[model samples]
Target: MMRITDHPVLGPLENKEVTIQFNGVDYIGLENESIAATLLANGIRTLRYSEKERKPRGIYCGIGHCYECRVTVNGERSVRACITPVKDQMIVESQGFQS
Candidate 1:
């Protein structure tokens, strides 16, 4: 997966690195950052899928306003990844067929 190792404007971000499990795969992300940000940093764009049309959905409005960025977190359903911070060992999964 593609990752943002360095940013031109922000340069290299210095934050506490933590491991989070996504779909049973381990990925390292920054602690206290939003789950969506972590996922985007790790090249994860599709967060969930629509129940009706089964369309892929991702971050939109990114501030807890839109529900498109919903994902399952630690067995909890409909969790907003855009606003939820990444925690160490947190299990996150895309809401694939769950409605």
Candidate 2:
């Protein structure tokens, strides 16, 4: 559960539950949640495979410093999911080398 289920500092994040699309698949998430958080809560890791090495990666730093959580948002490339708020109708896709 992303180890946030009973976090010591953040506690439980507040947000209205919502649905969003990830890679053409609809998934339930919180509106106030970061895209990476939502994906982690839903047991989604490996946000993208590295272009060269093709290594599996998920959220490395929750502060968005690392690009491990980057994903496409509404046709934009390299959107950091660790900081981007989840929004309704947002289109998120895992980026590939050719993308």
> Which predicted model would earn the best lDDT?
1
- Candidate 1: tens digits of C-alpha lDDT, residues 1-99: 444444433345447899999888898888777788898988888888898888889999877888999999999989999878889999999987644
Stretches of candidate 1 off by over 4 Å are 1-14
Tens-digit lDDT track of model 2 for 1-99: 443442333345555777878888888787657888788878787788888887777889778677888899999999998888778778889987523
Residues forming the 10-long window of minimal summed lDDT in candidate 2: 1-10
Which ten contiguous residues of candidate 1 have the minimum total lDDT? 1-10
Clashing residue pairs in candidate 2 (N, C-alpha, C atoms within 3 angstroms): none
